[model samples]
Target: MNVAVIGGGGREHALARKLAQSDRIETVYAIPGNDGMRDVAEVVPEIGETDFEKIAALCTSKQVAWVVVGPEAPLSEGIADYLEGRGIKVFGPRKEEAKIESSKAFTKDIMEKYDIPTARYKAFTDYDAAYSYIESVGAPIVLKKDGLAAGKGVIVATDMDEALAGLDALMADSDAPIVIEEFLEGEEFSLMVLVNGDYTHSFEIIAQDHKRAFDNDEGPNTGGMGAYAPVRHIPESVRQEAVDQIVGPMARAMVSEGLDYFGVLYLGAIVTDKGVKTIEFNARFGDPEAQILLSLMEDDLVDVLEKVDRKEAFTLTFSPRYQVGVMLASAGYPGSYDKGHTIDFEAVREKSFVSGLKQENEGWVTAGGRVLLVTGEGETIESAIDSAYHNVDQVKFNEGEVFIRRDIGRHALK
Candidate 1:
């Protein structure tokens, strides 16, 4: 079967790479793909990520059997609805179900309704009320822009000053509401599950995502700096508890709510001394996590999804090796910094699932914030981290130092 992965980001690149490895798959295409995917996918550069009309037309013309939506934005924008409307099968949820990620308040509400454990939060469209709530609750609270911010809209305020500023910044826009939550302290790990609700079938794997832009968990949050799997710090019991207590309840909630979900569900949860609690939910595969975990999958991604669609009993397999990935971002990413650096991705493409590049003069240059990913495998988390960083340093970028958190997997060492 011919498959097309929509969206041109690291997640899409990783999806394209894995699908290309499938023997059951005849062809793989990446819609508006980047240079790193060139080895594996036919890059359809003319189509935009959300260009539904052209995507359906291209799918029809290309005889694309399945369209995999890689990023959340296109899913939130209803690409699945359009493609499915055109009689093309899609491996993603619809727009209404995509509210799982598109709106934080929506998820919070669902969690509340289902008695799912999560941080206590209040959604506010009124700036004064939000500011007052922060002042009343005190420091070390999480203030999130209720809408999508490319994973950067969160402000973990350590004090009243920062809290107010964060609220002001988020509420500066008219329609952007804010959600302030009581901070829950714990080590965070995310589990990605292919969920087709009806309580039918699901497959889950856990990964630890380093969100802080700088080392030692400092600096503001970006989409994610790096990731490794299976996470070593969080206990297997706690992770299982998350699946039974959190993941299960949420899936049942979707069914009861009359939402037919068929796609990836990223359950971002934290292991607290009290118990496992949800941090957030994403509608599709995560970028750095996808690059790492998918590389470890022993089964073809196409084959697994197909079995899930058929409601067949199947076990998703993973290599014994632990996989790690470190992101190389433009020097000033998650804020503002550099771009247009001439980079030769040839050296790292094989070991990486990269994005944020454009070909010019037969050379590549940084086009977005998070540029590339280098993945490495090992029997231990420490060796995996070592392997990933070692390969990342060899990437050919004709520019000054790039930003990377040196302490990505150090928690495992601790």
Candidate 2:
């Protein structure tokens, strides 16, 4: 089968690599793909994700059997709906279901309506009203922008003063609406599920991403610093509860609301003393998490995605091994930074054994603002982190342009 993956990030590169290894796949194509994907698939340059008509035409012409939407922006723009409406098979949720990630206020409202476990939040379009609410709520609040702000929309304020500043920044200067939520204290985890409206299959629960730019959980938030699978922090009982109370309920609620959500349902969850509560919902896969999950997935990528797109029931087997992924970004990332910086991967690959799997050097190249994802798999999370960091240390870029978190799997270590 011929498959096409949309987006130009490390996540898409990982997906392309996995699909290329499938025995049943004849060819894989990536639209506007990065340099890393060149070794695994044919990179098409003309069809931008937002240009639906052009992309659809390319798919038809290329005889692409399946289309995988990678990023949230295009999915939120309804690319899946447009493709499916044209009788094309696509692995992504429709635009209506995508509101769960695109609009924070809408997601909070839906959670309240369906009784989904989540942090208490109040929405405001008026700046003064939101400021007043923040004062009442007091310090240590979570401020979120209603519209998409890349991954920096949500802010965890340390005090009332910081909370007010965040509100003003999001509502006053920015045209986007703001959502001020009660800050919930807990360790976080990421849960990804495959949903076909009526049926859903969950992957192994993994530790949450380190969104901050530096190590020791300090500094401003970036898209993500790194992540690992099979988080030891979450007990089996807690994971089961999350599946039952969070993932399953959210899937059912979306189906009941007349939205036939098909494809990946990414949930950002907090394991609070009161049980698990959802921090946010994403219609597609998570970045660094996706990299680690795909590394540990033993099933054929084509088979799993096709089943979901066809709305057929299926199960996936995961390797017992743990996987860790470390992201290397340009220094000023999550802010303004230089692009097109040259990277050297030869020294990086020699640092560790990554699952004992070897690949051609053509796969190593700078793809996005966040350039490379150094991953490792081991029998335990400790070994995985050790292996991943070993490889991450060897990579080099322009001076003062490389930034990554050093404590990707520390929670699991504890």
Candidate 3:
């Protein structure tokens, strides 16, 4: 089978790499792919997500059997709908369904309507009205832009003053509308589901991500610093409940609304004493997270996507082992940063547990602002983290600095 992956980022690179390993796959193509992906797949320069018509034409011309979208922007713009309309098999939610991620207000409204557990929120287009609401809602508030802002829109204000200030930044300064929500306190975890309308299959839970740019979770939000899979913090039972109550029902709700959601459903969840409530919903896969999550998946990714597109019942399996990834980024990331710098990963050493187990260096290259993802796999979260950081220490880049959360799997360790 020939596959075409859309988008040019570490997530797409990870997807392209995974697809290339499939025995059923004949050729893999990436539109505007980064330098790192050139090794695993043929990089096409002319085609991009914005050129939907040209991309569709290329899919037809190349005899591409499946199209996988890796980013939210194109999916929110309805690339999947366009491809499926042409009788092409594409993995992603339709535009109408994608509004769940494209518009924060829309997602909050849906959650309220369906009684899906989530933070209390109020949408505002007027600054005064928003500020008044924040004053009433009190301190430790959460502010979010109605539209996507490349994973940097949401702000957790530590006090009433900060909340008011955030409202000004999002509503007064920015062109997009704002959503002021009541901040909920708890441990956060990411849950992703592969869905075909009402049918859904869940993957292993992971808890590795640096939302803030600075260490110790202080500073502005970022796209993501790093991520890992088989999160130890979330118990298996709790993870399953989240899928059953949140992800499954949400997909079914979209289906009921005449939107056939066929792709990845990323749920940013908060585990509280009141059960799990959704922090946000992403129509596509999470970055860095996909890098580590997919690395540990034992099942064939291509087959899983095909089954979802066909709306057929299929069982997916995951390795019992845990996976961790540390992202090496340019000095200034999720902000103004340098690019085109040379990177080196040849010094990284790989470790293993089982006898006869051999390790492989996937090679290193500059692909995005966040240069590379160093991943490690092991039987336990502690072992996985140890291996991942060991490899991360060996990588070198010119004028580059990396930041990662120290408590990636702290909950699991407990």
Best lDDT goes to which candidate? 1
> How much is 394 displaced in model 2, in angstroms?
2.0
Q: Name the better of 2 and 3 by TM-score.
A: 2
Clashing residue pairs, backbone N/CA/C < 3 A, model 3: 232-412, 233-412
- On lDDT, who's better, 1 or 3? 1
Model 3's TM-score against the true structure: 0.91
lDDT of 2: 0.79
lDDT of 1 by residue, 1-414 (tens): 899999898989989989999988888889988777888999989889999999999999989999999888889999999999999999999999999999999999999999999999999998778877888889999988876788898999898889888887888875867889989998888888778885444444688888889988899999999988887566788878988899889998998998988998998888888899999999988878888888888898888888878757777888888888888888888878777887765766788877687878988888889988778778898788888888878877654546677877777888
Note each model's CA RMSD in angstroms.
1.4, 3.5, 4.7
Q: Which lDDT values do the candidates have, in the order given?
A: 0.85, 0.79, 0.76
Local error of candidate 1 at 378, Å? 1.5
Estimate, for each residue in 168-223, the C-alpha lDDT of model 3 and write its tens digit. Answer: 77876677778888889987888778887788888755555667766567778878
The candidate maximizing TM-score is 1
Pairs that collide, model 2: none
List TM-scores for all candidates, in order. Answer: 0.97, 0.93, 0.91
- Model 1 earns a TM-score of 0.97
